[model samples]
Target: MRKEIHLEHSSLKYPLPEQFVQELSEELAFMNEYPSGGSYKTLSAKLAEYTDIAPDCILPANGSDEVIESITRAFGNRLILIPIPTFSQYEVSAERNGLNKKFVPCLEGHNYRLVYCEEDLKKASLIWICNPNNPTGSSIPREEIKRVLDIAPGIVAVDECNYEYLGESVVDLIEQYPNLAISRSFSKNFGLAGLRLGFAVSSSKNIVEIARYGQHFRVNKMAERAGIKVLKYLDYFQNIWQEIARTRDFFIAGLKGLNIMVLPSKTNFVLVDFTTEEKARKIWNFLRGEKVFTVAGWEQEFSGLDNQYLRFTISNQEEMSFVLELLKRFPENTS
Candidate 1:
């Protein structure tokens, strides 16, 4: 039996659109052709329509991870500043490029909120802020984001992978600050994780520079077709997002009922801190033994700081209920 339930992966638990699946099946014929180089013309235009940004301002990459790497490469040798316990990719990308990394812990005793000082921002050549931050699922307020932008002299990259869950965005601020860039992904809301599609929205100048670092025909041909198909079903995607938000809140409430300390989240997952590390580990093992996968806080190198902290993703109500029921019975396994 597999030792893990693979619950740490972030994406919708629901099915992809039937139309998208069907169209993708049909578009498999195009796999024989090479992907279009530079900006994906059709997909870029479709994204432009969705984001209300010019096509030239978008740069598509095989995945947002690649987009991050490209940004790190282009900037070259600037200090990368990040808030603690955010996405790991930012630090990993910086290390891979031999760039210095500075981490300022988010608001202590305040659930990891963005709390960097102006001096911190001034020293950074690139600042990566994950809106609706990963692992913690806490969002830095828009006003705080604006404050960071105002003081930072370098480029600011906002990773909005979970933005749809929050229903807010800073994309509008792009025009106001030439140094700001927004990275978005199709993996989360669009259910396109397997397709590995992501893009960056920024000033035309920045987009052009990032595009130069991107490999030719890097995006798979089939993924582009899938992207175009998914864009047409935007309504379906929106509906799914609403359902996810509803279920996520319901699940969070259930966790609270069980006395698990859940951090407030605008993202699709909850960060739960168990009262004791022993309890957290025992419950984590019990859930895995029951074939219900969840993320154990110890799985990541940075996670052990809080042995009680576990990250849980919201799927459907039924799954949430099962997880909650198991937690309610946690006392039985505590011995």
Candidate 2:
């Protein structure tokens, strides 16, 4: 049997620099000490310098996963409205916290673009929207996001884990709308997924309340040191983001040439539709045999349309080319 490609993986396929590794090694001496109670203070100061928000507005967590959990905990038992086919964690978090979930399914014929009408916004106590949405890799327009924020007075969590690729963010909107909270992850563009560090940017009042739910030393000491080092090489990070975007466009164009229908993506991944579920499964197995992995389509209550779609991440030029070549020779196994 061929080894299966782990489609659930969602991080950049790059290694951290030797310098970053060295810095992490130096921090090993402090590993025995507990992380600062307010883990976000120094990290937040650096982020605030970059985002122009006060350090107090930033709340660091073990990962954005924990940040989502903290928010759900803070707003317990409220009706949560999520636009369907998004990050599964939103639903998982809601269920774990005993919050009721109401989903607004994205229109199938319309490539799953967010259809957040005023009525949908009115129904949610909290709304989680992924800009450059996951699995599908489509981005909601900035104006549309603002409209949702305006219509929905409830907490709106914008997960911008893939924000570096898109170069658009609503971080500035946090000051104007108390209900808005933006989640940023060092995992994606920064290549720190294993480190599991991320932070939420929101108003100071909201941060204070959310911080109450978060543990004093939620983030590990090593991850904090890694984050601080990454900040120092911010320019290098930007260059990598640009390279990923370039490679993404190149790969999408190649997919189009092969008649593989791919949605326009603002993130590092592309969503391609296969002719049938069996064909998709065959391609997935073939890729796995070659050590290439991508995300499989959601196959549950939301499986009415395009159960054959697959999500592929953009990597370095050489690896991306190899994957594309392998895709070009993909066997026609519709059975």
Candidate 1: C-alpha lDDT: 0.81
Q: Which candidate is the best by lDDT?
A: 1
> Worst lDDT window (10 residues) for model 2?
298-307
lDDT of each: 0.81, 0.79
Off by over 4 Å in 1: 1-6, 301-305, 332-335
Question: Residue 317 in candidate 1 has what lDDT?
Answer: 79
Name the lDDT value of residue 114 in candidate 2: 68
lDDT string for model 2 (1-335, tens) is 54433334668766677787888898998888877768457877887887778888898888888888888777545678777777777788888877898877884743766687787688777888888787677888888888888998788989887888888899989889999988888888888898899888888888887788888888888888777778877777888888888998999898887777788888888777886787888888788778887777754322223568777878778777787788888856312
- What tens digits encode model 1's per-residue C-alpha lDDT throughout 227-288? 77788888998888888788889988887776677888888888777767887887788888
Query: Would you estimate the TM-scores of all the predictions?
Result: 0.94, 0.92
Candidate 1 is scored at a TM of: 0.94
Report the CA-based lDDT of candidate 2 relative to the real structure. Answer: 0.79
